[model samples]
Target: MDPLTIGILGFCALFVLLFIRMPVGTSMMLVGAVGIYMIRPQASLPVLAGEIFGEASNYSLTILPLFILMGNLAGVSGMSRDLYNAAHSWFGHLKGGLASATIVGCAGFSSLSGSSLAAALTMGRVSLPEMQRFGYDNGLATGAIAAGGTLGILIPPSAGFVVYAILTEESIGRLFMAGVVPGVLLTALFITAIWLIVRRKPEKAPQSVTAEPVSKRMASLGRAFWIIGIIVLTIGGIYTGVFSAVEAAGVGAFLALIVTVIRGAASWENIRDVSLQTLKSTGTVFLILFGAFVFKTFVGFTGIPFRLTGWVEAQGFGPTAVVITILVAYIVLGTFLEGFAILVLTVPLVQPILQSLGVDLVWFGVLIVIVLEMALISPPVGINVFVVKGIADNVPLNTIFRGIWPFWFAMLLAAVLILVFPQIALLLPNTMFG
Candidate 1:
């Protein structure tokens, strides 16, 4: 069989294995190994060994574990609770204010954590009960937290973008810079959607402000300084070239640990729990990354990605049309796959096609993240929704799904903005990295 045909078969087989409930990492590694063996029997074993070793030893990949540790530390440090309190005190007086505060709090936590599940689960636990106590509609309360959690990925230090940068050989710093504008824009759009929904149906978000003195509000805000300091130091340092991506991650993790320890949040028990959770999360990410590395090698050996790009280019489609098709494919696949898996599986193949079409990689990266953001809140297997559901068990699943509709629309709008004005995504990266 031709290399292209072999590649196609391998791709299909990988997905089939995934559909059968096989582990994603194992499935990809299995397909990739077999494909490589078929393509070049003499070199397959040695190449597979080298690929595994190289992928495992990569220094850039160490950033993943550090970032995960930072997030886990922040979660255990009780930072989310302070952030939620600060947001609630400022916004809780208005209709749907608690929901708005939830979104804002999630965004803040995302800046420190850089994991959607962490942000969603942490914020949901901290804010859901408060929103419920205030008589906020269950749908709005749960849905806002779930949808807002996606900011964790779109914001900087994003694990998804880190993986993409490593796979594509793009500048991680540039990719991180590219996310800032779009992240803030999406956050604003989500807040707007909540405001509009509440305005149209005030009954859905009845407000109940506690009679707290201004002194109490100021005190609550004081507790959030650690979160603010960590974000500013991490993001600001990276953008200014004062720190490399890995250095920033390490610094952030250290600061988080110190703050947790100083505040008495990181006891022996808390440290044990955080360490174990971080290890589990880090291991899962690295395993999948190794699988993707092997799969990409197989695809390259088969020459499938090149042929597919050629075939698509020969179809007489314009650049816009081709880009549209790729985005649509991501949306469909996203319904069933996790965001990281989808990114790993498709980016190696899609990126060359995009480069050939004169598209900007940084801009495209931001756009792809927006699409992945949608997947985070979509039904069936949306991880964010599941996180929220797990935290707020009494709220029916359907209500959470129903509440996410407006945010979904808002996300679509954000995607369109990135598409129509690529500058929105590219400006910061270009200005900073040029």
Candidate 2:
């Protein structure tokens, strides 16, 4: 069979495996290995060994564990609750204020934790019951938390950007810098969506009967200063050229550990649990990354990226149209596939096309992360939705999905703005890196 035909069949087989409930990493690794052996039996084993070793020994990947540990440690230090309380103190008086507070809390936590699931889980645990007590609609409450959690991957220290950077051979720092403006923009859009929702239907999120006292609000903000300080020191250090991305991760993790200990929150049990969670998260990410590298190798052997790039050039589609097409494909695939899985599966094929179009990858990285945020709330396989549901089990799955739509559309709008004005993604990166 022609290499393109082989590539197509390999992708088909991959989907079948995924449909059968195979783990994404294992499925990709299996399909990639089998395809490589089919095409070049003599090289398959060697390729597999080399890929595994390369991934294992990769210095760049050390940042993953450090960042993951930093997040887990911060969670154990009561920072998530402090963040929520601080936001609620400031915004809880407005219509849909609790929901807005949830978004703010999520954004703050996202700056600490780069994993969307962590943000959703941590903020959902802290904010949902309070919103429920205030007579907030289940959909609005859950939706805000889920949507807010998506910011975890768009803000600095984002695992999504780290994975994208590794896959595309782009600079992780540049991708991170690229994400800052878009991340803040999305957070604002999500809060605006909440306001619009509550304005049209005030009953969805009833106003707080009494505003927080100024003294109490200031106290809440003071309590959150540790997390805010850590975020500034690390992310700010990166922008100021004081630390590489990896150095930032190490510093953040170490500082988080120290704070936990000083706060008397780092009991032996807490320490052990944090360590274990970090290990589990790191292992899962590394497994998927290893599979991604192998799968990319297989795709390279098939020459699909080149052929696809040629075909797109032949068709003469404008760059904007090509980008829109890719975004649409990502949204559709995101409904069925986990965001990282989509990243790993498609970047190999799409990278060449985008590069050929002279598309700035730093910009594309932010754009793709935004779509992935949408996917986290997209129904059927909305992982963040599921994470929220796990915590708020009384809310029906459909209601959680319903709540996410406003925020999802908010995300869609963010993506559109970024597309129309690439500078939204490029400004910080260029200014800082140049």
Candidate 3:
């Protein structure tokens, strides 16, 4: 069979494996190995083993475990609760204020945790019950948490970004830097959407707050300064070249551990728990990454990505149109696939097409992340939505979906903004790395 035909069959087989409930990493690795053996029988096994080992052992990949450890440590330390309380004190008095605070709190927690499920589950446990007690709409309450949780991937220290960086050979630090402004912009857009919704139908969000003393509010903010300090030390250190991305992860993890211990949050038992959780999450990511490496290598050997890119370039679509098409494809796949699955499956195919079109890879990276963020909150398999639903069992799944619409719209707005003004994504990386 022609390499193109073999490539198509291999991908089809991978999808079939995915449909049969095979683990994504295993499915990809299996298909990739078979495809490689088919294409070059003599060298396939050794090549696959070497690629897997090389990809798995990269120093840059070490950041994944450390950042995840930092997030787990922060969770155990009860920092998210303090941050949520601080957000509520400031915004809880406004119409739809509790929901607004939930979104804000999620963004703050995303900055710390860098994992959508962690952000959603953590904040849902902390905020949902309070919103329920205040008579907030179930949809709004759940939606805010679900949607806001997606910021975990777009903000710095993002595991998804790390994976993307590793897959594309982009600078992890530059990609992390690229995310900051876009992340803040998306968060602001979500907040604005909530404000607009409440403004339009004030009855939807009835506010009931016993105002805290100003002193108490000040104290709440004071206690949350650790989040600010961690962000500055970790991200600021990266941008300033004080540490490489992996070292920044270590710095953040160490700082988070120190703060958690100082606050009496991280006992030996808690440390044990954090270590186990980090190991599980990190292992999962690395396994998937290794599979992706094998699959991408197969695709490269098959010449599929090159042929596809050349074909697309020949079709003469405008760069903007082609970019939109890729994003639309993500939305469709996102309905069923997890964000990481989509990233691993499509990035190799998409990156070459993007580069051939003369689009900036870093800008495209940020844009792809925004689309993946939407997928995280999308229905059915929207992981973050289910996470919030699991936390607030009484809240219907449909209600959670309903609540995420405004935030979804906000994400769309943010995507358009980035699409139109690539500078939002590019400025930070260029300014720092140039």
Each prediction's RMSD over C-alphas, in Å, is: 1.5, 1.0, 1.3
> How do all models score by TM-score?
0.97, 0.98, 0.97
Which candidate achieves the best TM-score against the true structure?
2
- Model 2 TM-score, 2 decimals: 0.98
Residue-wise C-alpha lDDT for candidate 3, range 1-434, written one tens digit per residue: 88889999998999899988898998988999999999999768987798788977788888888888888888888888888999999889888889888888988888777898888888888998998898887888888888888999999889889999989999989999999999989988988988898888877788769677899889989988897678788889888889998898898899999999899977889989999999999888888988998899889988988988889978988899999999999988988988999999999998898888888888998988998999998877888888887898887788789888898889988999999999999998899999
In model 1, the Cα lDDT at residue 417 comes to 89
Local error of candidate 1 at residue 430 (angstroms): 1.4
- Model 3: CA > 4 A from native: 210-214
lDDT of 2: 0.91
Model 1 segments beyond 4 Å from truth? 210-216
Cα lDDT of model 2 by residue, 84-178, tens digit = 98998999998898899999999988888899999999999999999999899999999999999999999989999999999999999998889
* Backbone steric clashes in candidate 2, count: 0
Mind sharing the TM-score for model 3? 0.97
> Which of candidates 1 and 3 is the stronger one according to lDDT?
3
lDDT of every model, 2 decimals: 0.87, 0.91, 0.88
Better of 2 and 3 by lDDT: 2
